[model samples]
Structures are given as structure tokens and as C-alpha cells.
Target: MKLARFTEQGRTRIGKIEGDRIVDLSAITGDNHSMRRLLNHYRDWLPALQAATGPMFALSGVTLEAPIADPQKFLGIGMNYRQHAEEARQAGIPIPESQLWFNKQVSCITGPFAGVVKPAVSDKVDYEIELGVVIGQRCRHVKAADAADVIAGYLIVNDVSARDWLQKSPTFTLGKSFDTHGPIGPWLTTADEIADPQDLQMSLYVNGERRQHWRTSDMIHTLYQQIEYLSTVMTLEPGDILATGTPSGIGAPTGRFLQVGDVMRLEIDGLGFIENPVIADCAQEVMP
Candidate 1:
């Protein structure tokens, strides 16, 4: 089932998507005020939510939002895709010895259809379309074999990056965590909704020109392996997200970085599609 979080009037609410309408689930558990809170009761409410029905509202005209606005952690893997890693190597980045991880600040999170502000400080903005794995329960030291049990579902993630800052700074977090950089969701798709997360086709297009196209089968390390690796370091809490890296065809390698008005469209099979417009920084005021 496709569960979406959106705002109507002035309040944020959760809903179940069916056909071209949204079945309101705001009153579902009576305890989940936000998607972050809903994850705490995801298992218990799954059955009820799937079987529920309410006032059907048109899917359009609602203010859609990131599935979970306030997750405890927003981590991402780097160069996990075979072709992506190859591109990195060709671009002078060393081959990874293990799953490389980076932090994408929660503040960067934005709705899937929102505009991504091209920071005034950088001219080399880039896009990385990745499958976002949303954790369902808190766990540590989980084995890859048991990782599926802890997963809630999947979503799309546009891991936007600022190349100059990324390359100049010693760490990847700052460049990757710019506000509005992490565009996620249309909704969260439960794991049961997906038969196998490892064989899906994913693609990205810029202004209608297809740039990246690959399958989850092309990932060097499986999502379960990434789960096991991440869980061992820190507890994987409900609503925690993992952007499992991106495929090749990034703009920086071709010297074709984004300009102020470019649009990026990303999609993953069984998940959803996201289209984000790029705007100049001056068009978006920086928060003090």
C-alpha cells in the first residue's frame, strides 16, 4: 500500500493512496501525529491501515511532504552501485574498500516535488538518484539475513550534492547536507508491497534527457548488507533512513553541472517518481 504524508489546511496528516484518491488515516492509531511518530506504531497499524477506508479525497491539490519530516538519522552510502563506483574511479575517486557512508542532515529533507535551491556559494550542483531505505524498528548488531525484518519500506531519494564543497572539505556531510538537498518521497511503500527490492529498475532524467539508468541488481552491496553494517555502528531507529548510494552518469564528471533552472526527474520501480526544479540561491533566502 502507498502511504503518503501531506498537509491539508494547516495540519499535517497521513493517508492511504488508492486509485486517484487519498484515504485519510489521520485518526489511525490516535497516537501518530506525524510520520515519524507513525513508524513507532507501523507494525500494529499496518493491517488496520491497509484495510481502512475514509473520506476519499482527490490526490491532487494537497500539499505533499516528505514521508517522514523528522527522522533521527539520515545516512547515505557512497559508490555502492557498480557503474557509479566505476564512474567515481574514472573521475579520480578511489575505489571503495568497504561500504562508504555519509551523513545527510535531517534539515536537508524536503518534499519529493519541491524545488532544490542551488546554493549561492557553489556552481557545481549535482544529483544522485537513490533508493531510500526507511527502517521500521530499532535494532543493533542485526545480521544481513535478518535485515528485512527491521525494514519498514522504500522511497526515492535525490541525494543532491555541492561538488566544490564536497571535494574541498575533508568530510562529505557538509556538502551533502545543504538545506533542501535531500528530496524524498511521494510516499512510503511497505516492504510487503515489494516482492524483492533488489531487482528493480531505477532511472534519472534531466530536462527530459535520461542521464542515469540502472537496476538495484547492479548494487555492489545489498541493502541488507548495508543495514547490517549500519546497525552495528549505531542503533537503527524507526523512521531512520538510508539512501543506498546512486548509479553513474552524474553531471560533475561531464562538466555538465546544473544551472539555476534545470529540473531533475527521478524514479524507481515499485517506489515512485520525484521531479524537483532547481532555482538560484537568491531566489531562496537563507535562514539566519
Candidate 2:
């Protein structure tokens, strides 16, 4: 089932998507309508969600919010795609021998259709389209073979970057964690619905022009290996999002950066798409 978090009539709720209509799950969840709660006890709620008969809302009437609004961790893998690694190399970054993970702070999370700010401090905004994996259960030291068991579903992630800040830190936290930089969702397409996560076709378009297009098959390290590598170090919890990696065709190599009017649309086969517009950051508060 496609599960989503949305707002209608000024109240936010969770629901299941059904052919342009949403079957509200709020009634079943009662006061505990957070996506994290649903993911934590997904097994227990699955049956009820499958048989839910709550009120349906027209998809256009409600605004979809980030599916997992406040995940404990929002992480990303860098250069996992062979071609993207080559592009990164062209931009003076070395391809890692193993998974190169970074944190895209949870606060950077934003709704799929929200506006991404082009911070006044920098002008080198760019986009990386990636497959986002949502963890369903908490586990540590998970084996590659058992990785699939911990997965709840998948969604689209636009790993927006500020290239200037990116070069200042090897950790990439600063560049990748800009507010509204992480645009994920449309909804989570449960793992059971996806036959092979590694074979999906994904792409990114900037203002109707295709900028990045590649398949998950191009990944240098598989998602399972990434999970194994990460879990070996720390616990993976429900509602944690893993941006598997981005493919080639990011703007950094070519010197093209996002402007105030550009819109980024990311899509993955079976997972749906998310489009976000770029807007100027007008906040007057000074960090200094």
C-alpha cells in the first residue's frame, strides 16, 4: 500500500493512497498519527490498514507532507553510483573504496512539493536524484542477507546540495543539510510491492529539462551492502531514511546551479515522483 502523511482542513493526518483518493488511517491511529509510530509497529497495523474503511479524500484536495517528517536519522551515501563517482572525480573528489556515508540532518527534511531555498550565502545549489530507503524496524549488526527484513519501503529523494559549502567540509554535512534540501516522498511504496529495489529506473528533471537519468543497476555498492556497513557501526531505527546514492548528471561538474525559479522533479519507477521549486531565502537573521 502507498502510505502518506497529508494535511486537509488544516489538520495533518496519515492515509493510504488509492487511485487519486486517500483512505484516511487517522481513525485507526487515533491521536498517535505520526509516521514514526506507524513504522515502528507496522506489522501490527498492516492488517488493519489493509482492511481500513475510513473516509476517503480526493488527492487534490489535501496537501501531502513529508511521509516521515521527523525520522531519527536522515543519512545519505555518496558516489555509490559508478558514473556519479566518475563525475565526482572530475570535480576533484576521490571515489571511495567503500561506502561513503554522510548525514543530511533530519531538520533538512521537507515535503515533496515544498520550496527549496537558494540561500543568500551561496549560489551553487544543485540536485541529486536518489532512491530513498525507509527502515521499518530497529536493529544493529544486521547481516546483508537480513537487510531486506528491516526495510519498510522506498521513496524519491532529491539530495539537494550547496556546492560551495560542500567543498568546505569533507563530511558533507553542511552542504547537504540546508533547510528544505532533502525533498522526499509522494508516499512510501512498501517493500512488498517492489520486486527488485536494485533494478528501478530513476531520473531528475530541472524545469522540464532532464538533468539526471539512470537506473539503480548503476550503483557501485548495492543497498544491502550499505545497510550491512552502516548497521555494523550503529543502530538503525524505524523512520530512519537512507538516501542510497545519486547517479551521474548532477550540475556541479558542468557549473550549472539552481536559480530562484528552477523546479526539480524526481521520479523512480513504481515509487512515484516529487517536484520542488527553488525560492530565495529571505530570512533576515544573521548567523554571525
Candidate 3:
């Protein structure tokens, strides 16, 4: 089942994405207001709801937004893709020996297809196409064998970065925490629907030119391994997200960089695509 969060009036609501329409999940499961709770207690309700198809709005009628709003934590892993890690090496950065983890301030999250504002202060904005893992339950020190069980589903993530700040600062916090940088969703596909996450094909296209293409099979650390490694350090709660690192072909590594009006479309098999227009913020507002 494809899940989404959309803006209706001035408020945000959760829904189930069906053929060209959205079934407001919040409308059916009265009093249960969030996708997180629905995933936890009413996991079985999806099929029944799918079959009970009622009035659904056309796909183009509503605006698409980030599927998971207000997740407890947004954890991101760097250099989890061998090819991407190699790209980091070519830039004179050492390949990490362990899963390199960091926090994306939740506020950076943006709707799918939303415009990504290239910060005015940094002219070196870059993009990273990654597979996002959404956890279903409270996971503490889970083993690799138990990892998949804790997963709710997957989504596409663009881990937008600011190269200059990242290279000059002691940490990556400022470079990665720009508002509207993290473009997620299009849809959040449930785990059971995806037979094997490891074998799926993924790619990114910039202005219709294929830039990065690879399979999840090439990942240096598999999704389950990422789960086990991160869970040992912190509890993976319902709605907690982990973005397994991007593949190669990012701009900075090749001496090419984004300019105003560039469009990036990233997609993974089973999970849908997210397309965003890049706009320059020449005013240089300090990141919030």
C-alpha cells in the first residue's frame, strides 16, 4: 500500500494512496490521527480499507507532501553505498570503517517535488539520492536477523548537501540541515509489498539526463545491517527514519554543481520517485 501525508486547507492529514486517488486514513480510523499509530495497531486494516474503496480524489487534485511528518528522529547514514563511498575517497576523504551516522534536524524535511532552496551563502549545493527506511516499532539493539521485522516500509530520499560548509566545518550539521533540502516521498511503500528490498534498481535523473543508476545489491551495508548497527546506539521508534546513503554520480565529485532552475528526479523500484526544482537563495539567510 502506498501511504502519504497531504495538505488540505491549512492542516496536514494522512491518507492511503490508491489508483489515482487518496483515501483519507484519518477520516476512517476516527480518533486515531497519525500514520504511526495506524501502522502500529491497525496494520491489518490496509487490505480491508483498500477493498472498501469509496470516493477518492484524482491524483492531481491534491498536493503531495512528505509521507512521514514529525518523525521522532531522522537518522541518516553516510557512505553506505560502496560506489558513493569511493566517490568520497576520490574527493580526498577516507572511506569510513563503520556506518557513518548523523541527525537531520526534523525541520529540514520537505514535501516531494517541493522546490529546494539553494542557500544564498553556499554556492556549492549538491544532491545525494538514497533509499529511506521507515521503522515500524520500538527497536533496541536489534540483530540483523530481526531487522526486517522492525521495518515499516521504504521511501525515496534526496539528502541535499552544501559542500563548502561540510568541507570547512568540524561536523556536517550546518551543511545538511538546510530547510527544504530533505525532499522525501512521493509514496511510502509497505515492506510486505516489496518482496526483496536488496535487489531493486534505483537511479537519479537531472533535467532528464540519467546521472546515477545502481541496484540496492551494491550497497556496502544492507538495510538490515544498518538497522542492527544503529539500533544498538539508540531506540528506533515508530516513524523514525534511516536514509541509507546515496549512490555515485553526485555533482561535487565530478566538478559539476547545481545551478538555478535545475531539476532532480530520483526513483527506486517499488518505492516511487521524487522530483524537485532547484532555486537559488541569493539572500544568504542563516539556516534555521
Candidate 4:
């Protein structure tokens, strides 16, 4: 089932996307729980909940929000694609053999179609298209072979970066965690729906120009390995998010960067597209 969150009458609710409408789970079960809460107990409630139904609202009319609200951990992998790593290397930056990971604080979460605020303090805003993995089950020290079992679903993610700030720190948090920078979710397509995570296609466009075009099959460390590698260091819990790295063709590689009013469109085969328009942030407005 496609799980999502939407706002109706100023209230947010977890829903199941049916066609172009959202079936309100709260109204069906009469419980005020978010998607994360429902996902925790999904095994018991899902079967019955799938059978029950309530008012279905037209999806076009309801405001779509990030499908998962406030994920426990929002992790991102950098340079996971060999080609992407090579691009960085060509830019005089060394690429790491192992996965280089970073955290995107939950505070940066934004809707798929939300406007991206280009911070005034930095002039190097950029866009990255990535596949987002949503954990369904908790697993620690998970084996690469068994990693797929712990996955719940997938979503399209745009990992917007402030290139100037990113280079200043070894860690990417400061550049990647800007508010409204992490635009994820049109909806989470359940694992069962996607036959193979590595078989999907990814495409990214900046202002209608195709920038990043690659296949997940090209990932240096596939999803399974990424999960296993991460689990070895920390517990992977339900509602945790992993943004598999982007492919080559980022602005940094081409000496191109985002400007105010730029539109970025990111899409994966099963996971729907997320389009965000760049806007000036609080600081940008004060420029002389």
C-alpha cells in the first residue's frame, strides 16, 4: 500500500493513497496517531485497516506533506555511487572507499513540492536527487543478505546542499541540513510493490535541464550493503530514513549552482517525483 500524510482542515493525518484520493486512517480506526505510530504497530493493524475505509478525499485538492513526519534518524550516504565519487575526485577532492555518511536533522524536512529557501549567507546552493529508504523493522548488526527484510518502503529525496558551507566542514550537516532543503516524499511505495530496489532509475533536473541520470544498479555499495554497514555501527529502527547517495552530474561538478527561483525536479521509477522551487531565505533578502 502507498502510505502518505496530508493536511485537511489544518489537521495532519496518516493516510493510504488510493488512486488520486487519500483514505483517512484516523477516521477509519478512530485513533489520533501519526504514520510513525501506525508503522510501529502496522503488523497487527495493517491487515484490518486495509480492509476498513473512511472518507476518501481527492488527492489533487488535499495538501501533501512529507509522508513520514519527524523520522527518528535521517541518515544520508555520500559518494555511494562510483561515478559520483569519481566526479568529486576530478574536482580535486579525494573519494573515500567506504561509505561516507552524514545526518540530515529532522528539522530540515519539507514537503515534496515545498519551496527551497536559498540561504543568504551562502551563494552555492545546489540540488541532488537521491532514493530514500524507509526502515520498517528494527535491526542491529544486520547481515547484508538479510538487509532487505528490514526495509519498509521507498521515496524520492532531494538532498539540497550549500556548496560553500559544505566545503568548510568535514561533515556535511551544516550545508545539507538547512531548513526546507530536504524535500522528500510524494508517497512511500511499500517494499512489496518494488521488486528490486537496485533496478530502479533516477533522474534529476535543474531548471528543466537534465543533470543527473543514472541507474541504482551502478551504486558502489548497494542498498543491502549500506544497511548492513550502517547497522553494524548503530541500530536501524523503524521510521529511520536512509538517503542513498546521488549519481554524478551535481552542480559542483559542472561549476553550476542554484539561483533564486530555480526549480529542481527529482524522480525515481517507483517513488514519485518531488519538485521544489528555490526561493530566498531570511538572510538573502538583506543583501545590498
Candidate 5:
């Protein structure tokens, strides 16, 4: 089932998407209308959510919000796609034998149709289209074979970056965590709905031009391995998002950067798509 968080008539509520309509889960969820809450107790609520008969709203009439707005952790893997790693190698970045991860501060989270700000201090903004994995349960020291059990589902992630700021930090946090940088979710496509996570196709388009296109099958490290690798270090909690890396078509390799007014549409086959417009940073703060 596709679970979503949306606002209609000024109130945000949890819903289950059916065709073009959103069936409200308010009565069933009570005051726990957030995706995080539902995901934490997903096993317990699955039956009720499946049998929901609440009032329905046209999907177009509501504004969809980020499926998980306040996740405990938002992390990303770097250069996990074979061709993308090769491209990074050519750009002077070494390929790691183990997984390379970085943090994208939770404040950067934004809705699917929100605007991505082109910071006034930097003009070298770039985009990386990636498959976002949302964790469903808390676990540690998980095995690759057991990873699927902890997964809630998937979504599209546009890992926006500020090239100049990126070079300043080896961790890639500053460049990756800019406000409005992380655009995820039209909604979450539960694991049961997806036959195979690694076989899906994903792509990105800027201003109507195809900038990146690749399949999840091209990933050098599969999603299961990533989960296993991460859980070995720390507890993987529900609502934690793992951006499973982007493919070879990111703008950074060619000097093609995003500018104000450019719209980035990122799509992952079964998970759905998120299109965000690039807008100028209008904040008056002075950059030293």
C-alpha cells in the first residue's frame, strides 16, 4: 500500500493512496497522524490501514508532504553505483572498498513539490538522483539477507549539492545538508508492493531535459548490503532514510549546475517521482 502524509482543508493527515484518491486514516491513527508513528508500529496498524473506510479526498486537492518529516537520521551513500564511482574516480575521488556514508542533517528535508534553494553564496549547485530507502524497524548487526524485513519501502531522493561547499568538507555534510536540498517522497511504496528493489529504473530531468538515467540494478553495492553495513555500526531505527547513492549522470562531473528556475524531476519506477523547482536564496544574511 502507498502511505502518504498530506494536507487538505488546512489540516495535515495520514492517508492511504488508492488510484487518484487518498483515503484518510485519521480515525484509525487517532492523533498519531505522522508517518513516523505509523511506521514505528506498522505491524500493529497494517490490518486497520488495509481495511480503512474513512472519507476520501482527491489526490489533486491535497498538498502531499514529506512521507517522514522528522526522521531521526538522514544518511547517504557516496559513489555506490559502478559508473558513478568511475566518474568520481576520473574527477580525482578514490573508490572505497567499503561503503562510504555521510549525513544529511534532518533540517534539509522538504516535500516532493517544494522549491530547492540555490544558495546566494554559491552558484555551483548540482543534483544527484537516488533511490531512497526508508527503514521500518530498529535493528543492529543485521545481515544482508535479513535487511528486507526492516525496510518500510522506498522513495525518490534528489541529493542536491553545493559543489564548492562540498569540496570544503570530506564528509560531504555541509554541501548535502543545505535547507530544501533533500526532496523526498510523493509517498512511500511499501516493500510488499515492490517485487525487487534493485531492479527498478530511476532517472532525473532538469528543466524538461533528461540529465540522468540509470537502473537500480547498476548499483555496485545492493540495498541489502548497505543496510547490513550500516546496522553493524549503529542502531538502524524506523524512519531513518538511506539515500542509496546516485548513478553516473550527476551534473558535477560535467560542470553542469542547477540555476534558479530549473525544475528537477526525479523518478524511481515503483516508488514514484518528486519534482522540485530551483529558486534563488532570498535570505538577507551576509556570507563572510
Candidate 6:
């Protein structure tokens, strides 16, 4: 099932995508609250969702929101792609022996088609199209072999960053957490739908120009390995997110950062695509 969160009329609702329309789960039963809760108890909801009937809405008419906006641990992996790491290495940044993790404040979450606010404080805003993994159950010390069981689903994520603020700290939190910097979703495709997570293709484009193109197989450490490494350090709870990492072609390497009115379109093989228009300092949005 393709799970999503969206706004129709004036209220936020959760639903399952059925071609060009979405069947509102809330209209079916009062038990469903949010996408995060549905995922936390996927086994129950998974079967229940098949019976969902609702006041449906056309996909184009409603406002799309981030699939799971309330994740507690919004984390990102740095330079996990070997090709991207090689680019960083050439730029004088050492490649990490293990996964380099950072936090992306949950408040930064925005919808797939929403306007991405280019913070007035920095002009070095950059985009990193990443494959986002959302956790289904709380687990720690997860073996890489058992990691697949805890995954709920996946989506396309834009790890928008401000280069100036990123280099100001070692955590990469300050720069990564700016409001509206994290734009994730078109919708979340369940893990069961993905036959091989490591073999999917993902790419990103800025204003019609292709900037990134690579497969998840190019990742230096697989997604399960990342789960194992992170779970060893902290509890991986339901709704927690991990940006599996981005490939090369970020603005930093070419010094071609995002400016107002630029549109970012990211696509992952099974997860679908998300297009977000760049808006300056919250001023206004440009056409998609």
C-alpha cells in the first residue's frame, strides 16, 4: 500500500493512494490517527487497510504533506556513497571509516510539493537527494541480517543544507535543521514492495538540469549496515528516520548552490518522485 499524509479542505488526514485518488483512512475507522502510528503497528494496520473505504480525494486536488512528519530521530548519513565520498576526498575532506551521522530537526519537515524556504541568513543552501528509511519498531543492537524486519517503508528525501552553517559545527545539526529544509515524500512505499532495497536507482535534478544519478548499490555501507551501526549506539524507534545518503552532484562540488525560484525534483525507482519549488526567505513560492 502507498501510505501518505495530506490536507484537504482545512484538515490533515492519512490515507492510501489508489491510482489518482487517496482513500482516507480516517473516514474508514477512528482507530487510525497518523502515518507514524499506523507504521508502529504495521501488522495490525496492514491487514486493516485493505478494508478502508472513504470519502476519497483526487491526488491533484489535495495538499500533500511529508509521509511521516513526526519522527523523533531524524538522522542523516554523511558521505555513505563511495562515489560521493570520493568527491569529498578530492576536496580535502577525509572519508569516514564508518557512517557519519547527524540530526535533522523534525520541524524542518515539509511536504513533497511544498515550497522550500531558502533561509535569508545563508545563500549557500544546497540539496542532497537521499533515500529515506523509516523505522517501524523500536530495536537496538540490530544485526544487519535482522535489520530488514524493523523497516516500515521508504521515501525520497531532500537533505537540504546550508553550507556556511554546516562547516561552523562538527555535528552538522545547525545547518541541516533549518525550517523547511527537509522535504520528503510523494508517499511512503512499504518495505514489502521493495524486492531489493540496495538495487534501486535514484536521481535528482535542479530546474530541468540533471545533477545526480546513481544506484543504491553504490552505497559504501548498505542500509542494513547503517541500521546495525546506529542501533548499536541508540534505540531505533518507530517513526525514526535515516537518510540512507546521497550520491555525488551536490552543489558544493561545483559551487552551484540553490537560489530562489529553483525547483528540485528527486526520483527513486520504487518510491516515486517529489518536486519542490524554492522560495526565498519565506517570501513566496514559484510555480512548479
**Per-model lDDT:** 0.89, 0.92, 0.83, 0.87, 0.92, 0.90
* Better-scoring candidate (lDDT), 2 or 3: 2
**Per-residue lDDT of 7 in model 6:** 86
After superposition, the stretches of candidate 4 with alpha carbons farther than 4 Å from their true spots are 28-33, 284-288
Comparison by lDDT, 1 against 2, better one: 2
User: What are the runs in model 3 whose C-alpha is more than 4 Å off?
Assistant: 9-11, 31-33, 44-52, 282-288
Off by over 4 Å in 1: 29-32, 283-288
What are the C-alpha RMSDs, in order, of all predicted structures?
1.5, 1.6, 2.3, 2.6, 2.0, 3.2
Ranking by lDDT: 2, 5, 6, 1, 4, 3
In candidate 1, the residue pairs with backbone N, CA or C atoms under 3 Å apart (3 or more residues apart, or in different chains) clash, namely: none
TM, every model: 0.96, 0.97, 0.92, 0.95, 0.97, 0.95
lDDT of 2: 0.92
Poorest stretch of ten by lDDT in candidate 6: 27-36
lDDT agreement of model 3 with the native = 0.83
Residue 22's lDDT in candidate 6? 93
Give the alpha carbon lDDT tens digit for every residue of 1-288 in model 4.
888888888877878888878888875445554666766787888787788576789988888999887789999999888898988898888998678999998889999889999888888988888999999987899999999999989999898899998888778899889889899999888899999899899999988999999999989889999999999999988889899999999999777999998899888997778899998878634546
Instruction: Say which prediction, candidate 1 or candidate 4, comes out ahead on TM-score.
Output: 1
lDDT, candidate 5, residue 68? Answer: 91
Q: Which digits, one per residue and each the tens of the lDDT, describe model 1 over residues 159-203? A: 999999898766798889998999999899989999999999999
Per-residue accuracy of model 6 over 1-288 as CA lDDT, tens digit each: 888998888888888999999998885445445677777667866667877767789998998889988888899999999889999999999998778999999999999999998888897999999999999998999999999999988999999999999999789999999989999999988898999999999989999998999999999989999999999999998989899999999999889999999999999998899999999785464757
Better of 5 and 6 by TM-score: 5
